[model samples]
Target chain A: MEIFDILLTASFWAAAVRIASPLIFATLGELICERAGVLNLGIEGIMVIGAFSGWMAVYLGAPLWAGVGVAMLAGMLFGLLHATLTVPFGLSQHVVGLGVTLLASAVAYFAYRLSLPEVTSPPKIVPFQPVEIPGLSQIPLIGPAFFNQTPLTYLAFVLIAVVSIVLYRTPLGLALRAAGENPASVEAQGLSVTAIRMGAVIVGSGLMAVGGAFLTMSAFSSFFFEMVNGRGWICIALVVFGAWRPGKAALGALLFAAFDALQVRLQQTPLGALVPYQVFLMVPYILSILALVLMSRRAEVPAALMVPFNKGER
Target chain B: MRLEPIPNPSALRSIGLPAGALVLTVIVASALALLAGANPFATLGLILKGAAGSKFALLETLNRATPLIFTGLAIAVAFRAKLWNIGAEAQLYAGAIVTALLGTGILPLPSALLIPVIALAAMLAGALILLGPVLLKTRLGVDEVVTTLLFNFIMLLFVSYLLEGPMKDPMGMGWPKSPALEKAARLPRIVDGLRLHWGFALALLSAVAVWVIQTRTTLGYEIRAVGLNAEAARFAGIPVGRVMVKTALLSGGLAALAGFSEVAGLKGNLTLDLSPGFGYTGIIVAMLALLNPLGVVVSAIFVAGVFVGADSMSRAAGVPTYIADILMATALLTMVLALKLTRTRIRWR
Candidate 1:
């Protein structure tokens, strides 16, 4: 089969959308947090907790949606840890973020081992199957790619649109942006910068946990150690590539997903047959670096990003 | 209550506060162990026994601490210059792959020459990997945190590929690992019949070397100046960018030594799971030391004890070994919080 013929298949697009959904959820979440001037290095840990909690809920016979709820709750608790450390205590953001990640991920692993220590194979759960919208999925490639997706994937798209609307067209979004840009100024308006920033972090973390839940509940059927992998880190990078915009971040997620799909497809081709499949795996990361190099020149980060907002001090 | 920062943070206070925090962290960790249906005292006893109860256990703990010291020092150096080299894991993996390749008979050299050459190659490969992030930050103002982190995933994938394809052990039963290094290229053991090796000595020596460089040299002063305030350092005629890049290179090079130590000192081979997140744990080590090079030695050993002890604890107590990780992370969090509290008085007015 020709390379173009292989690339143009509906299945490829469908796979791309499916693969990209987790990142979509995560990047959108990260974008919101970064836009509010908090760079959460705990994304990896939060994602791990999310994946673990979601898996645990399912393993305990809870429905998939309930698992997602548990994951979000876990993410919020972790986020609160971050906020308490970096905000009120005014400790280093990087250290607190790293600490939370280490703690959360270790706890996740411990819980998993404690719950299921003797499984020879990773215990599997009934993963969310893709919902085929009766009327919409009939439409060709677009339908299968967009309409025929898991409910989580559909939520991810809706989140993109909702986040876009919230960020660009709302007063609360304005407060978040101002808080990120100049917290002192936002505080001058009698709006508590700490509250706004903390809310952004918690909300963002919840979304990120949902993204993590999607991995165990919908994307894959089982939870393994380090199952979230580095998708959280990828989301962190995509936030920069997207320049803090939800739409752009979502698009970046898709671009990465496309690369992921292409790599898997490449493994089937004669060219890929000649090379180790890991070579294809390197493409997305290398591409992200290149993209960052090219785009970062013009990218504008939040002025207060990574800087802890001290309420009364300069 | 409001916190007021102390103008001059006392050394005793700094040390005392974090120590107290560590005690609290242990109490919290013990509570967690209790929640897990294990006797906290038994778990603690197992950890102590596993870590340093016997000579053999002590050697294993030392063996584990060696790599952490290298990576911790690597982090301390870069952090002193305010450069975030979060890609130490990638650098370590790169170095391990390079060191392994040199030992695989690919280079036609004498054993003595091959060992030194492999070390140099590892250092160079690790530095080169970090060169991108350093340059990006200095040139385009891109943040190194995300870039360095992203590179880690990329490098791990690269290492995974190498192990599966070019470096797969042929004689082994389909394990994705490189061929073991020549016996001549392996690090000599410091003690007979123990896993402890020359890497521990090297780690100790490097710590002293870093501490001396950090305190007793013009370059060290420059690095600290740049870290304290880059704008002031630049105004005071220091090349802030060059110092940042140089510090990053050194950090990467030292982190590479960790990979070398693991391969040459312990494993004698390269595998995908060569490091159980030692690179990231190094950050915790550095922070626990307050970014002090010499302090990294104690912190690395302490952290190593937690992990080593946890392993034995799990074996003996039927508790999950990850409690060690939880303990370390808790200590780190409390350490930073305690330090902050030390410098600030709570005003409950």
Candidate 2:
């Protein structure tokens, strides 16, 4: 009864929607990259770059949208590095991805410290305010959560539709799909698999950076160390859970955020008194593993996911 | 551009490329120093001075390298087998938790018997922690990378709970830390009144033992075969799944020793901040070492020295200590590319 009572609250759903925004953007980003046959393990660090750059930009007098753009650009630069190594040089994606994460995170932190030499705490910025759709906001239950949010959150929602369309409806989508599923087939079609895959990674990385920017420019309004904190990894899991489809991945992100929101709310109930808070915090990660086990069986990964393409190779 | 495999690369190719990468990394470092408005050569000198100019600085670098050597070996073993065991951080903490449980006045064995027992228990804990993901990977085809990474977050939360609850130190005033290890259970110092401990000796022994395992053991051959091509290894009558399980156990156990060494040797107690990303740093060490077990020791020392030196340099120069991390990342990327170039020739059309 208490669970039912809590589930009926609009604020809880709003919190869930807010939480899902970042995950949605990041999951779609990773899905795009994996679909193009490169596992951009640099998502974690790209998110860090986004968070720091977005927050710093707004703090330094740039508009909120400009901050998001700066974050995306920074993330794309790292993506270029990841693509250059893994795509043409045929380096190991795993090691290269981890290296990028380290590089991007250190860059953000080093730049932060250098730029703010005497400061003990990071400065705050005025983030994007939530904009409510008048009639939609008046609707019951789902109204406040879905129809009222900062511009970035709305952008995340819009991206889900855009990505699904681009992945399924466009000629570019077909080429991207061919690159991941069978690069040789793509080459036979006279399309360059290298360019398509690299472009996917660069664009996807930009989306991932936007996800991190969502945390700072909309959700938290401040940057902190480890703030990205495995969220990028979680989005990777979400991608698998959704079977690499943008729509399903977005839905998975929403479901994950709902559970996360429920866990936070549960801490205030009678159950919170009985269980350690850490148990609640561990739920999202533990659930990610369980979800992977449950869904991995049904997931059909791209055949050439981690395979490098050489034009003349068999 | 197209890549072609070299007919046979010269033996000197291995050393030359990585050395070139290091030079590039030095250029990157100088570039970073210029950005920070510090003298590049002066900053480099300060790092070297802080790392090994004094006996004390050298001792600190060794102490830092001790845990890294263990974790580096763990990563090297797992990576060579293609297990993608990124949960070394979680496994290390699992080992630390067990060390805390057994070494905090619980075990009644003498100094000689107690230390090994604690270490053994710690390794078992780490092995069992990784066993979950291994089982999942083998049984249901779950990706171990994500699972292992998620486990790190879960393990940290679990440790946080333990430190605040059952393992809380009574003498400490409301701090989240475990009770101190018994003096008899602690690893003895390598010298009289010196900062160095026997953990460094233990780490060196582990590196040598791992090198032997990789070169001289049947298990090592199976791991390499499985890594190179799992289907081929399976077709050759090697149990690919079993090899993976065994590799996980070995890798997880080695990683756990890092936690045991940190708890029972360096810190003498378990705290949340016991590892300053040493598990993650171990990956850099292993890659820098080119996944060679014996080379892990040298790379661990180098990585640890850079970190310690960078911290010292940050105070002297106006540069941030994070420059070392950037340096590490640059080194990893550049070296990996360099390693590839050793065996492959790039031709432009």
Candidate 3:
């Protein structure tokens, strides 16, 4: 292959990975939550809150890592709120999730506005620079495409493996899955279903918040309103598409990211020049529908995905 | 200790449920405002002043409420049939797109004929947009929530495409807006110089129409029965599937009116961000109304007041308009929790 062609292809792949980072993080988080029988619909809102908090922290002279920490703390707080409503209060999971999304969006918007008057130009936080592995950087096409990426991208890939191992290879994983599948049976076996589910929800929300923070800190230097957009919902779809498996969920994210990347690339192509840019933008959503239809016929969702579990219920 | 039986509750007690919920939401939202360093009472006073204190503000509030009332009713209608129609936002856009095309096209009709024709086009467009999800859900057992939500993105993109390409105004100087609708195709205003147009009346009529259908018709009974318990309705020989399909389509059509009203009655041109989450806000409106048709009108107006007030509050208090949204969400959450508390508890056993 020509050098120029190789460079173009490598850049495309790089963009794809960068786009997939947030999705991957969120999907893995959702996988854990779903495995424990709690459906965290507040993922989108949590991500938005994370983006704002992270941006605010970094914009105020805190380290970028500190932003991540603040984002995770915000996510944990939201997760606790959601857990209280759905788990203990036994409110509708779907309604509570929607409410949380609304509340989160409102908080982010207000916070952004409150800070707007003080700064003439929005403060730009430095993004995480690419860290190249010494020996891996010299490898073939894969080296530049995978190893020479931001720290968050590599963290996403590592998380997929870590989550997969934790979900399928450990006793805790078994107990969590059992809690979702049959909380009564799990409780009878001397496990605390509420505790397990709460842990999963908090962890999932924290991971999603980190994903949101990445959007503001790495992908875009300054946070815009609704920066997370619908990526959180996309993560929800990915969990279903991947059938609650971490590795498969990561693949789903990659697939979505690839399409999104292609859409962006197409905007520069001759064919894209003829059509409206909106059509290309719609490609991801259209593909999502097609994927949903295809998956619904074959994919078996968790047996107790949205159903609230009670301790004594058999 | 033995307890005596309680006395009969008054009418106020019954109405107090929703009223109390609304009050509680405001209190919580006010606390949040305090955290933001703004006085909740002062902020709310500004909102009230902006929404209803003056004629112009009231007109703006009505204009905002016009579409919300339609979308809220649309949501409530589908909810009554036990169908989760989250695609109202997309469906509204679909209606707006069709209305824009027809209203701006070279069809030379008088004002009387053009207006109705455009409105019908919007209704049909909305209904058509929702058909895919309706079919998938009723025939294939696909979840409408995901499909509807997904379609919202598609329709939004489609709208963006139209504005950027074929529908882009030639004289817009690179701005992404459609050409203004011909005067004949525009909705006439009832009052001069105010934003309030005939769409408010149309929305009112539609709300009444839905109320009549929901209360006086056999179809409404079937819908209510299905919503209460689908299997039981099916066992009772009610065609639950048909009711779901019809209700979903009706919901889409109603939501479409919101878009049509915005384009024909307000903007007179299609813009990219025509709705700032009006579709999503409709969900809160519907829930706050407890899915009651008449209640939807009152709830929609109240919500609209908040939005109008928020814009002014943002300007005056230097707070983000999103504080209004936070308040709205808090109100909705409280309302839902309160409703759940008042309902008969179900025992899984």
Best by lDDT: 2
lDDT of 3 by residue, B1-349 (tens): 1112225544565567667987887787677668768898987788889889998898899989999999999999987776878788998898788888989857789989988988888998898888898888887666677788888888888888788788999999999999999889899898787768999999999999999999999988989999998999999999988888788778999999999999999999889888887888898899888899898999999999999988997788766777788888888887776665454233432
Candidate 1 Cα misplacement greater than 4 A, ranges: B8-16, B105-114, B347-349
- CAPRI rating of model 1: medium
DockQ of prediction 2: 0.93
Q: What class would a CAPRI assessor give candidate 2's docking? A: high
- TM-score attained by model 1: 0.96
- Each candidate: RMSD: 1.8, 0.9, 3.5
Tens-digit lDDT track for model 1 on B1-349? 3468798878888788988998998897789788789888888888999999998898888899999999999999998888988889999998899888887777878766877788888988888888889999999988888789888888898888888887888976898899989887788888787778888998999899999989999989999999999999999999988988889888999999899989988999999999988899999999989899999999999899989999988988878888888888899998889989888866653
Clashes of each: 0, 0, 0
Q: What is the TM-score of chain B in candidate 2?
A: 0.98
The recovered share of true contacts, given per candidate in order, is 0.85, 0.97, 0.65
**lDDT of the structure predicted as candidate 3:** 0.83
User: Candidate 3 i-RMS (Å)?
Assistant: 4.8
Q: Show pairs that collide, candidate 3.
A: none
Q: lDDT at A284 for candidate 2? A: 94
The best candidate by DockQ is 2
lDDT of 2 at B97: 95
